[model samples]
Target: MAKLLARAGVASRREVERMIAEGRVALDGVVLDTPATILQSLNGVTVDGEPVAAPAAARLFLYHKPPGLLVTERDPGGRKTIYDQLPDDLPRLVPVGRLDLNTEGLLLMTTDGELKRQLELPATGVERAYRARAYGPITQEQLEELIHGVEIEGIRYGSINANLERRTGANVWIEMILTEGKNREVRRVLEYLGLKVSRLIRTRYGPFLLGDLAVGEIGEVKQHDVVSFRKDPTRKGGGEAPKLVEKPRPQQRGMQQIPSAPKAPIPKPQPARRITKTSANRADKAAFAEPTRQAQPGRDPVVLTKATKVKRFYDAKPKAGTGAGTEPVAPRAIAPGQRPKVFSPELGRNVRAKPGRTATPTEAAERKPAKATPRTAGKARAAPSKPARVKIHKSRTRK
Candidate 1:
């Protein structure tokens, strides 16, 4: 089997093995049992009932990936993948490197698995250029020392080419070109230097620059360039070299011509009219037109006629001892000849006395006892009660 599929051009060799296990890959009507099984060509192998063709010639493309897209074939979380952003007409190509979900910028893609592996190898020494904005002061000395190398969390990274662009307030912008791209290397290194990377954008990968490519856009390298690049083993893959082609510069013209001033038209005079005495008198009369005929004083400013007042009926007051709030009070019904019962608002209704009986004012006043004041221990002891007497006379008679 070709290493192309194993190198991620199609799928990993392990995945191919699984496909074989699932009877998806057939060799002359026989399902392959193991990945160790080798083949000279795709001759008798078919996947999903479709014949596998020989790998196409190697091609490379520059892709501008926007943030929030993953560089994976399939995400278990159903995230949008780079394959989804690629054009439908694109041939099978794998990302030369990965950009984290939050990182966006230039990404290299290649159709040839061998070419992809060749470019991505650390031995290739391909330079990837990135612009990073960090939140902290980074002196030129520190930047220069970065080229010497920096150790982050016990991991040693090779020297990097770093240049300070500018510093505004607390943030500093830096342009970095690196040969080796470790996971979050730029961010981790800057953080070790007491700086936090606020934004990171990959502007170039090897000889290919992003160059105004809108996010999610892809552009292919000329076929001749691809062949030339492959032939030259010394070619640095990223944005380190440019072909000798004289780019035309825009031509400058002289200052714009001033426009001519427009001519102003002359005003014409009208004939004068003679004023008669009557006309003068008419003008004076019009100037003093009789003061607007004073509106005759209207019927004495309308006296609001008193409207027939409607009688408002209110609920009867609750009995005396009952609560004086809005809560309903039960009413007491008595026989016609019985004296009206005294109202007790606190009791929530009228209280009726028995026939031929009436509660005196003293009895009514004494119905409830007055609250007693707290007393001292000595005062409490002074109060005493009468004692009971024994009946000895009945016991003597019985004896």
Candidate 2:
């Protein structure tokens, strides 16, 4: 019954249990007095004579509780409570846990009572931290002993980690962390050590920090952060844990740290040789030098390489009247002191013969001057020279 009312957003599970014990809860017109009554739904249930509304989306707030403000809705002594300090437009909210009037710092408030119950349960193992300004002659060893928690008035505290900061004139700042938040835990613990606590500020609750939030001010945790905290609220600050960032690996202690990427080896520098203008000119001349050759005839009269193959290639082509058809005739290679043959048009053939052979008179006689064909026999007559310039003599007989 209590859980159902809480799930319905009537109040936190613990608060609902308290209300049931007070006979303020009823089911189907019957006043209920026990939280153990199990019910399927809140179809006709009433809490404090009012219908319970359906559950709402989870919302959370981080409030910086200032000293002297009670963390309650009402105080019998007419003292100021946390609700009076909140904005009027704020939604109905319940503190996740109590921060006594004298204690100040981070106090988580939420609209989802179930979430409040989840976070406040000691089984969740959420850590809470407080920095106490105490006047005492405390030592590090004395504080470390609190790891094995101490008991006062027959009530035992769970393990706590306490550390002492610097001291000035018997006034010291001490930091203590504990998973459970028993009432007046920090003050009583310090007082047991003969130290008078001047102030008690809870600097951390679960995973949330007090940070720079001013006194009596409130801020909200983002929805995603609240969801993450509800998923695993067992961390320090009772909320999302601080992101664990990897620290860059530093130089190894004993052995030097190895470089991730190999360093490029630098090339050795060479001594530059100094070259004079005279030496430079000599080198340029040598690089461009040509071996002198004896001059050959039928070759360029100037400085040029002889192109013997080019002339041979063209000469190898068959003459137009060659009887060999289109077959290219291999040119007879003319050596030094040798001459190429000529074509004999009168003979109607090329008369190239053996090298060093002299032609006989009969053969020479065989070569005759070519006779013109009819097409070529008739010569075109030049324009007849203008009729010889004739100046008629004037025959004026004694005129």
Candidate 3:
């Protein structure tokens, strides 16, 4: 069946069905007439007249893929592929994910299709690091903003830890780390910020690094390291971090029993002490008590007020040219321990400037009366109490 072929790594289930329909699948030297035929074992199963091989052991390899090589197994244009650069005697391996033809660096490969699918999934929370050379004018502040994430062409990218490494005129270098491996995500995000990426190289993937690995070189991950890596979880609260693992070697001891240490018992939490109403009231009074002022010999004692009273800081220096009096304000006292129900003066703007105008407290407090102008001097005066019109008319008639 198609499931058997897929499990054997011949092709996907759907692809196996397609091959069966095309008469490419056979059993016992006879071409399969239909996909409905079932087989429990892959002993006599074949595809395209080729025998189906047994599933290979789970193996992982780290490859330093070159820039021009395609990550896929085949290219319609007959271009060079990642497999072409791999060393001989290596098993048939599948890439974890596809890297662009021009983008190069750490690329993971595995012999098991299931492992490839697990690592390739975005939910794995595997981080990919890249160093990009771009051309534009940018600052550290601008690159730091990528932490909050950015939206490009209606596609939103996850949080990126981007840092500006160096700059040479319009050309600059930046380092970026992101969890989502969206297609052309890095290039698109930089381009959105008015930067054109010239070259991009992935330096790290998860805990694996491409340190000093020459282009087209491949290396196998140690068995113990792979086990440790596979133990890591992709979701929050899934499991703990990977433990330190030693290199694999022949076992010296066999069938020996070792006991683990006994764990200590956890202590139970104690109940909190409850504060009485009278104690709470005392604490409140202590917090709100104001400073006391000693009474003068002949003057009444100043009763200090609670925290609810107004407190003002008056500047004592007078204006140089105007000679306005800058007397310090007298301290006003309220009854001791008196907590006013209304709001304090600080919260109340006593003299508010008109909207669209700004006025300081000192200017509002030191304002003076306006003086009359020359034009309004005569009009501002009162008229004569009695009119002398009758007397003036009689004198004129006599003249």
Candidate 4:
């Protein structure tokens, strides 16, 4: 009966057993007293007065649980739980393992209670990895001793593979991998080592990682991957753990106690070689040193380098018009006593320049007739003059 309730996604076998002991599990309104009751199916079984639904195909999801959320479905103290953060569309699921209220990272959620038990069982030997940031002095040698396991305050912890990743002052980051995840195991172990854990984050579990999954985001595992992983979870082959990022050592005021890795002496960037006029001349001569080869009738033409093309462009003279094939304008010479003439855009013609002042560009102005004022009221008003008409000359045609 416990197994039936567990497989039906009601809860874990242990929890179901507890529910039966509490008389919450019933068969057609008659509360079942024993978890060992003979039952072929859950047809008439009901838990907490709700009819049990048939279990669906097993499904798995990877949820990046943020801190401050409990793993349980509900909390007695009204604290937020993982279910509150989960999407409403997700099916009834249970966590493979529990994370502390403040611990954050990769959390496996599954629909099958049986599968969850299989994963959470310490005998299955599925590894769980965590990165803990703790304060206190600890050495790699001390952490290495955990491989043989340890007993703290009468509670025994299984063999743990631990390594000191890096340190900052009195604080250090440690990476721990273990199979048996006892309640408050990580914090207790670190506390036994005289280290106060400031932050704890689970990085990997079994074959899943919390890789790049944002806080509170959930992702489903592929059906094929879940199937393959279930075949042989104890195998050392699983998801690759991300490299431990070493925290930058803070700059100290005095000589360092621990010697850091020897840094490669940065070769003083040699002052950039200055291009002298002599070197420029030599380069220009060398560029054209090859005899100019003429293209033969049947041979391929010479390809010009970018530099050569640019040189030719600058050396080319400006043309009078924008046409590509227009003839280049010849340089105009000025007489010794004559001032240079400048183009007056306002006048639409080239005008002689004054030696003292320069021409300032002005906009084209329209000419208006002069108006007679009161002082000139008695005087005859000038007649309005007509605009001058220019004659158009047409080209003569050959007759």
Candidate 5:
């Protein structure tokens, strides 16, 4: 066999197995039953009833994927896939790193399956940087612990560099850099420490950045840059064959070399105060005591009487100028024919008439109504004469 399918670039040794299972691939007018079943170059091979063509050269691109997109070839639940957001002009590409459905950031995609494998393998050691906003009280000490390592649900996670960027109220923002991409590692670690991850965004993946790349945008890495990245010493061998370094575990005090457990913190004793017998007796009496005065029948309630007295006391005096319970009194009304002893203006001023004072007949006669002026009298007489004359003239003219 010439490895005819592989020569045609239809798929790799692994994908051919999957294609055979799907029944879309056939050989010599018969569908292939298994990947191991090989044939000579003369055997007819077809995909979707059409002859397969050789694949073009591989290409790589950097995509800024927004949240709510699934990083999969197809989702069984009919969820929107990253493929749906890819431009129509783009070739079929596999994501180098996966961003969860709720995660948004830099995602690398490649047309060649071999390149995808190379980038995703642990050997890549590609450092992924993320900016995370967490809600809870986080201290610099906690961030330093993250740099060492953290155990989550019995799974031991490796060291990661985390820094506290800023704190606002109960929420904090942190910048984290990790080489190994674990599933929900950042979120899980923070949650284990009683913190809530409110937002997560990948700012950079290796050398590629998400800067200014709008959501759903796909950008191709320059050919020269791709070549340079492949040769980068930092990403050399694609995280494969990482050098192992032995870490010294803390020693135990016993003769045997047993792993020592963290020591339990020593608690400090609080101060004890001595209480006197008199003070205790007074407190007991106060707690059990009742009011000394008993209620009287037909009397206002004690609370009501107290409230009424307070209201009256406040109302009688000006709030600030006069002292309480010492307001000035207003004068009382006087009865008729009883002269007030002291005639204050507010009481009512009195004007007494002089004795034997009478007006004479001449004086009384002089107070007559003043006569109307000649102009006024003339106008009054002329008003009635004009109406009478007009009526008489009309009767004469008619006769």
Candidate 6:
């Protein structure tokens, strides 16, 4: 009975059993007591007081779920759900796997609960790819180490092919590909590595991608493609996956059949040609062979070196009062009590006179300024002497 309900797109087998336990599934106005009570057909069977519709052909849809929406049908907290964002004419679809409220990316929706279960099972080894922008210091070597997998908080995550995409100031973008998508696995693994994940986007899942799928938009997979994918989930590299479709006309929503254009013939890939040492030597000789042309009389002969090519520019003429080998100008005479300023070789100009000090033409410029004091602005005040003690008072106290 559970299998029948699951195949009928009512729910998964386990969910059907749970519904029976809750007395929500009834037949002939009598609630079912157990899922074990099997019937050949769903004659008068009803789920939640509604007659179950006949199982139509299995359908698959790629929905670009935006962040901040629950994947469930309804939320007890009255938060928005994925259903609220979907079109009104979409069928009773179920998400293959749950995406967190803050995780935005590709979500597979299917009418057949059995198909959903099959796709969600980890044993299927369908690869899921995600791009995460995290804030922290992470190196390419550290990300590469994730290929061995990491364990955090007693939960052992499977091998992940993680690569450092690029760095943005204090944040880094990481691309990770994994098969086992345990609950919060990506977040947990990244945080354990001392990274704070700011944003995570699932770019690819199995053979499908979230390509060009606008948020809140959905595109259905053709029936033939769905059947082929179910037969072999690991298939790859034959053709491009379906893209996210725009909203159809209200009248043509579910019944419209998109005509596929003829596909161009793909040329068979040629095998790589193996080269022997002799062939490699021949190729090298051919590449390095000198041109047969004789050098022109007035032109410099072209020289080719194994090192990088460098273009030598003509040496620029020295500007006025600059460059080496130039004679130094004599210092001008200084008037009495006035310091003569010295020209700084490093500064390429006359150095400024030191504060409260004089400089000679040959004197080196002061490297630092003297510390300022209260006396710098005015004359220093003399310390006040203590008052003279009275000897008569002391004598009277002694008497």
Note the Cα lDDT for every prediction shown. Answer: 0.76, 0.80, 0.77, 0.84, 0.72, 0.84
Instruction: Please write out the lDDT profile of model 4 over residues 1-399, one tens digit for every residue.
Output: 887777777777788889999999999999989898988878888888989987766788888889999989788999999988777766778888899999999999888877787789999999999999999989999999999999998999999999999998889999999999899999999999999999999998887788887787788887766777788777654553332222234578886677788999988888889999999999999898987867786688677776545457667766557447877665788889898788987899999887775434442222334566565657886899977655555654332
Candidate 3 regions exceeding 4 Å error are 1-7, 12-17, 26-44, 49-51, 233-399
Clashing pairs in 5: 122-239, 123-238, 123-239, 123-240, 124-238, 124-239, 125-239
Following a full C-alpha superposition, what root-mean-square deviation does model 6 have from the true structure?
27.6
Query: What is candidate 6's lDDT per residue for 107-212, written digit by digit as tens?
Result: 9998887788778888988888899999999898988889998888787888999999898899999999998868888999999999999999998888888888
Show the colliding residue pairs in model 4: none
Candidate 5's displacement at residue 184, Å, is 0.9
Give the higher-lDDT candidate: 2 or 4: 4
Off by over 4 Å in 1: 6-9, 12-14, 233-399
By lDDT, the better pick of 3 and 5 is 3
Top TM-score hit: 6
TM-score of each: 0.56, 0.55, 0.52, 0.55, 0.52, 0.58
lDDT (10s digit) by residue, model 1, range 324-395: 765666687767887777678678888865576667999989987798978776664565765666667965
Model 6 lDDT-worst window of ten: 236-245
lDDT by residue (tens digit), candidate 2, 118-171: 788888888888899998788999999999999999999989999987787879
Measured by TM-score, how close is model 4 to the native structure? 0.55
In model 3, residue pairs whose N, Cα or C atoms come closer than 3 Å (at least 3 residues apart or on different chains), thus clashing, are: none
Candidate 6 local Cα displacement, residue 249, angstroms: 10
Q: Is candidate 4 or candidate 5 better by TM-score?
A: 4
TM-score of 2: 0.55
RMSD, every candidate, angstroms:
25.7, 30.3, 27.9, 29.8, 29.4, 27.6
Q: How many Å off is the CA of 79 in candidate 2?
A: 1.3
